[model samples]
Target: MLPFPSSSSSVMASSYPTRFCFNRECPDFNRHECYRPGWRLRNGDFADLCSRCASAYEQGKFCDIFHQRASGWRCCESCGKRIHCGCIVSASAFMLLDAGGIECLTCARKKVSVGPNFRPPPSFLYQSPIAEKFNDMSLDWSSSARSYRPPNLSGPSILQYNLHNRGDGYEFNQPTSRDKATAYSTEKQRGMNDLMGKLMSVNSNNHSSSILYNQKPGPNCKVPTCPNVNAYQPLISLKEGPLGTQRAFPVTTPIETNGHLGLDERYLWHKANSSPLSHLHNDLNSVAPLESKNLNFGIHLDTPGKYQVVPRYCPKVPYKNQVLQNLSNESVSVVTPLFEKILSVSDAGRVGRMVLPKKCAEAFLPQISQTDGVPLTVHDSTGKEWTFQFRFWFNNNSRMYFLEGVTPCIQSMQLQAGDTVIFSRVDPEKKLIMGFRKASVAQSSDQETGLNNNRESSTNGDAEPIDKHPPTEKKKSSMTTTRSKRQKVEKGDLSELKLTWEEAQGFILPPPNLTPSITTIEGIEFEEYEDAPVIGKPNTGLGSTYSANGRLSAEQDDEEAKDEAEGLLTSPKSTSKHPRHRNGCTCIVCIQSPSGASPKHGRRCSCTVCDTVRRRRETLLLRKKKQQIEIENKARKELESPNSDEELRQSANNSGTTSKNHEQRHAPPSKAQIDLNFQPERDEESLSPSNTTTKDKSPHHDETSCKPPSSSSVHSRHHHHKLHVDFADS
Candidate 1:
């Protein structure tokens, strides 16, 4: 009833046919009810069943629905198990095709012996051991070398042009399991082993037999029968006498000719061509062999080698620079300068040879061994390395070590005399490195000329005249009007003319060229105004005077005044009012108050400004009291141990006081005391006599006056007494 025939058609068309459910647990087992036209049949079994019956089958859902289709299925021959069609793609993958039949990879691996003709499983195609492929070929040097065969390019390729070509054999194509293992082995491979064994067994007794066997012509090789060919056939062959012994030729001229010789060519050739026992004469000769000619070498001025000794000299003599005298590294450095010798004419003439100074060799060169050469490397300024050996020879008579091999190094660096060479050993294992600083050619020439000129001048007794007052040539010409120039009479130098300001001003002269004119010149001017004022002119605008721009000048002055006022407020004398404080610009107290009156005017106002002033005054008074206390303490200390000057003054004061008391007690009485009564005013004078003496002892400049000490002195003494009169006064 379906467009496509049922999968059971192929099974039913066979002689033996029975429809059954492919599913194991189908209830209608082996019955036609579960076997629909769409049901698949495989291996004489129904692989597909009806959906209703399939539900009852145990593995109905899990079974491969396409297993019964021939195109979608394959059977692994060795295992007798069905494989998906895709899994059986290549004959080499999981299966092998043999003369017997196809076999799975597992069966093939177990039953098959891998040989030169064997094909590996597909998985092992890339994993085959490298050693196995060449196992049959000779690898040992003796055998492989003798039997090694090069690929024959003239031979036929795998692509057969003619039908007779057997290129499809295992050598080119994938070999089959039925192919003999020895089929891929070459004759050369088998012969190589036999040849190696023969060579190993070949001794004096059978050596000739082995040689003759190796030289035998093969079927594949063409015959060449010349005497030389027979002697050297198979590459290394020997010719022998009739008795099968090597024949040796007589000693002749040496092989290397033209005055150069070592081994004799004829002797070696004959020795190789004949057996060792073969000799031209049967009896050994009694005469000894002649000695070889002594080799003679030609002398060369310069050898063409990696390094050569071409004596050369510098173009100019070297000069010592501050680098040597002051360079810190030079002082303690083991690697120092070579020598101070100037490049001589002889040294300069030779191209590559540089004659180093003897001192240079001793100072810089390391201790020499018996070889007398120390390897050294010179690192140039550009960082290229040139290697050389510092060879030194001991001069027994001179007792000095002379350095050699410096010539090549110097030539390579292109060093001249003035170019200083410095050596250093930055690495212990590495050779000493040499660095050179080329002297400035121009500077050196200039120095030489200067020396010559100095010498010539000294000889000629010539001296350059020195001007005591060198005239100063002005670079910039100051431009001014004729009037200003005429008026530019030099003001007397302030340092030379010590005069008062008025006297100096009086000495200034009026410009004679000055003339009042209403007209002005039409010229470029720096000032914005048409009429620019002179230097110190009074600025009429804003009633401000200016030396330059009036506004800037006025602002600067205001700022300065403000700063002064602030300073005064914080100064020691806070009571002293600043001139700018009354200006109303900087008085914050007055600016914020109700009355806004200046505190400097001495007017009392019931405002916060007045209150602030009162508080400031109180603080000022307290500070003053602290300062006064400090001053009093300082004075007490001074009075305790007075200086010589103060002690003298105090002694004079004491003497004067005693003299006055004596005179008062004796007869001299003042007019007021005389009138009061002759009774001495001792009681009144006694009460404060100590205070008077103390006051007199205080520092006073005017000691010449008869008047009592000044108020300052009295006040000083008052503080001093207050300190001493402690608890009693309290």
Candidate 2:
């Protein structure tokens, strides 16, 4: 702005300077220079660093070069190699230890490679200062307070230890309780102090010594005490050495101990009160043990004035942590079981409504004064949330609660009638959770039977049993009586007859050659047979032979009858071979009795065979009439044509000769003959006198002189003659 610049200088000034080195500790960090790429950052961009710093980073000495003076520095217990735990660069290079140190990744891998059966030396397992004090207190209590039976607690007391890292030291937030009484008297306190002095003296020689204590005790306490036992304070100070400058490391102790040990019970008091970051230590400890006994943090006295480490069951460091975590999550998700109901047909039906008990609805579901109700969100066992309408319907002067829109959930779980649905609520949020249980097949079947019985009893009042005997006895008696009656019937005992009406009627046929006399009885016409009534064999269409019971006994007989009937109806041999015969043949020769024992029916009889025969005759007569009319039409068309007189005379002579021959053959003209002769008379009337004279003078005047008839005319004549013969025979 102070001076005008050249084009090149202006362009150079507008461009940005080369990025500075990403390492803040580098000597050239603020210098303007070209940068080389270092490690990739979380946003996927390479860190801009000067050449020297980039080279050191690639060599894997970035943390050592830059963070050498960081506070989180610890020596590995196994390899004795120093590791920087303060920065993310070396975060994956080391693992935290349960006692109070860090282990290099190399040593950790080596320890894990030693396999599950490997047990660490007793020196490696060190008890924390707090745990050591408790151990001393437990020893004193066991010796002096043997008869001091504390309150019979229903469950283990949970001690909350909340560790948070602040500026130089860690802050422990422990929950304080006021109801607990002082655990020790003056003598007990003096004994605890002496025991602690001895423990400190024994652990002072170890370089990795760590101690934690509270600077302030409860308002009633008189001696130094651990933060969790008899008294609690807001802040617990951790002292690692004489100068008390070292930071306190997280140490996990066994949660369960012998209930007889008064002070040992404090170990079970710790809850899940630690920060999320502290869980990493727990995860490492639980995973390191594999199959060996857990690395418990406690000291045991093997001999006088000598302390050694002993392995104990640590609940937090066991392999069942994952299982316990899952159980805890489940417990949190479903806190209280509100109510359960077996699904009815309507509950699981397509209607998508579930009926809830009145008390459960009022107590568990939200209060609803309106019928429209409120939309409720419910979580299933699978953790999927679903929204449903919770409403009530007024019924029987009371209210009935119903949950609607549950069909999708029911279908997803594949639940049906007779399955049980459980309703539960989460604790803090009171979230509604729906769960289901499938009903066993046996139980469902029994319920169905009960429902059927109840319906029957409700519909019709209960009926008393006719027999006084027990059900089994009654069943046996009825079966035996039926068997005896059947035997009697088979032996032809008419008094013990047990037959259906159809079967009984089939056995009584009308007397042959005798007519029934009709009489009026109470305005009803009855047919009475004068001759003795004859009992005939039952007609099952199988055969005349009967069993001892006079009934068709074998299934084979019915099968044979069916096969025969099918063959008669469908077989080609059943059809008539005569050309004149039509379909649906009902001739006397074709009709047969079902049992082959009845006589042929007469023509006048009003039976199926007679009716069929009459229909056939009428059909044939109609066909003949049509044929005659057709012939007359042809003759008229011939007459209308301008044919020669000789041709006309020839046609007239042929017609007259044919008529005379038919009359001679059938002296008394039959119905078909009469019909044939009518067409000839019409032809005779159509011919004029000139045409007759021409015909007389023609050469074909004799009866056999006419030209040979056409094949169609011959067929017509033969059909007429056959019809005449059939009529005469009938």
Q: Each candidate: RMSD to true structure?
A: 47.2, 39.2
lDDT of 1: 0.25
lDDT of 1 by residue, 329-358 (tens): 333111111222333222322343344543
Which portions of model 1 show Cα errors greater than 4 Å? 1-341, 346-351, 369-371, 399-403, 417-420, 424-431, 437-440, 443-730
Assess every candidate by TM-score. 0.15, 0.19
Model 2 regions lying over 4 Å from their true place: 1-334, 442-730
Q: Report the C-alpha lDDT of model 2 over 1-730, residue by residue, as the tens digit.
A: 1110011111222233534455656765646355555543212234455678767766667767886754344566677676644332443355434232446656765664543222221111111111122232222322331111111110111011111111112221211211011222233334333432332242223211111121112233332223322211111112231122221212222111221112232222111232222332322111112221211110010000010011100101001101111354443221333445656556766789988765445434544545766676777767788877777898886679888898998887656544556554442233566665444322222221111223221233332111111123344433432322222122221111223334333333222333545433333333333221212223212111110011111222444433332222222222222111123333232233423234445568876555544544454365446445654755786778856555544443322223343222222223332221121221232222222212121111122321221111111111111110011100
* lDDT agreement with native, every candidate: 0.25, 0.33
RMSD of 1: 47.2
lDDT of 1 at 676: 13
